[model samples]
Target: MDIDARTLRTFREVTLTGSFTQAARRLGYSQSSVTAQMRALERQVGEPVFERLPNGVRLTHSGIVLRDYARQILTLVGEMETALRRPAANPPRLTVGIVPALAYGQQLARVTHIGRRLLSGVQLALRIMGTAEVHDAFKAGAIDGALVLTVVDADDPADLLGEQQYADRSDDLTEVRLQEVEFVPVTGVGRRPGGHGRQVVIADPDCPSQRWLPEFLRLRCDSPPEIHELGSMAGVRAATQSGLGCAMLPTALAADHEEAGGLRPLPGVPRMRWNASLILGRHDTRPAVDRQNLTETLRQATALGRAARPAVPAAEVLGGAGLGGEVLGGGATALDPDTSIAS
Candidate 1:
């Protein structure tokens, strides 16, 4: 069957998003155009690639096979482009998206430095976005990659983006476990006196910490915490520091501020764990060895101190052979960065 690169990319986006409308939006195509492309592809292949459902579509057996081949072909195309490109005075750039939480603290500089070191001459562009927005940007081919959160529980069924078990390592895609952080509720020094208000400081709706923190409060308190939506991580931190409301934050960050008398942990609240991973698409134009080196550099950058309990390795976490595996449970988007600077 005759196939094309653009059509393959459309198919991959549809598979990733599980919706025609979303794929159309990502690819900047009209819904009718996306429909026509799929129809023509189906007619040529003489098989239904997608099992249509009311909510979304699922890949048929044939579609899964096709997806594998498409990935390989597109990966080769990316390699060829990298190999044949002429060198210029200005380096080719890759724009990577991260949530506000990741951009705070020292992570922005750390990642920026690491990206430059690992990729050498390539320019690294960092943009701040909500976690879901980051994923949407990736699907739209607007960004090279993103730092995303997945539940640590491998048995959970909702984590679709969780890495999958693979005997052979992928030359194209590279996933690196950066750090695992604990989410805890924090309140300003004045607010700690009573801790009685329903007001809860939160980031934008897309933030995972916002969702998780409220649920925790609902379970333990007689009344649900009032939602105070701050659009950015810095806003959340500032508001919480001023006693506007208690906010959920990383344990490390909370400790740093509590020591400085700016913020203190909320009484009678438990912390939850979240893992951060750098997700690179298999069809990304970067070289395989460079991707590998980037992953290693990230791993080293995020290494925890000896006094802290060791985070689960990526291999054991995903039930995969090594370095990569699909997350298989409910999706949590991003974690707040708690480092010295946050204090």
Candidate 2:
């Protein structure tokens, strides 16, 4: 019969309570509405769906059979409505650019896990690049976003901008500064200069340490050791652990090697401080297909603290609870929609 979902639900409710009045009350409908629905339901089936009693009512033989089919139809209708209401199961792919050092660090492992939960239905890809390559990737539109590591130094303000020349294009981009990451000089235990540890293990080209380490080493040691470039973090760690050379690595990675007694900090070498900032294409040119989802991803990713500069603008305040029961929760990002580079 041509019964609708609303009528079927009312019929099901009436059968559940065995009283039209009670069903109406529970369904938040007037008793007349329930009576009218039942009438239409019976009329469509050409038989009474309920047998009236002096007390309340009972289901007829046909009513009992109709009840089963009504429940199934209502369930199918509910499933259809939910499917139509939800956002697409897939959106445009989100390409993120990251430096080898950060990508290899412990924090990044956490970020990627949480970011995926935030960007729920979207495809995410990471492009491993050095500090300098990220700038070019963003300019060429090869990447949708990036996590850039900036050296935070007061005396050398240039470290803030460094190879990220996009600081000049304030209208084109915005950066949300994450927590500071510390880098330490580590070498295999008991190894010294002119040995396997003499050679410095570093990421190939464009790593900030590549420029600063040589001079730092020359001043600290009797004779500076040779530099050997390793492309991956695991390789660098393995090499350092086996006395291949001293590598400057994030404290988290370095601490792991130290705990095992396979590595130790180079004596008298100061730690380097860098800020992990998330870069986004700003304004109308923003590449994210689903702004709301991307905003939530940023919010969950930076749940640690508020931005030191301008705050997230003109969006719902979804606090950073870090992938709660609601994986596809919506929220705003800390990137100010209209940001100035000087800020």
lDDT of 2 by residue, 4-55 (tens): 7778777877875679998786566999999998998889999887889997
Model 2, residue 295: what's the lDDT?
38
Q: Which segments of model 1 are wrong by more than 4 Å?
A: 1-87, 155-176, 304-343
* Per-model CA lDDT versus the true structure: 0.61, 0.61
- Backbone collisions counted per model: 12, 0
Candidate 2 residues lying further than 4 Å off, grouped into runs, are 1-86, 153-161, 164-171, 193-197, 221-224, 287-343
Check candidate 2 and list the clashing pairs.
none
State which candidate has the highest TM-score.
Answer: 1
Q: Which ten residues in a row have the lowest lDDT in candidate 2?
A: 310-319
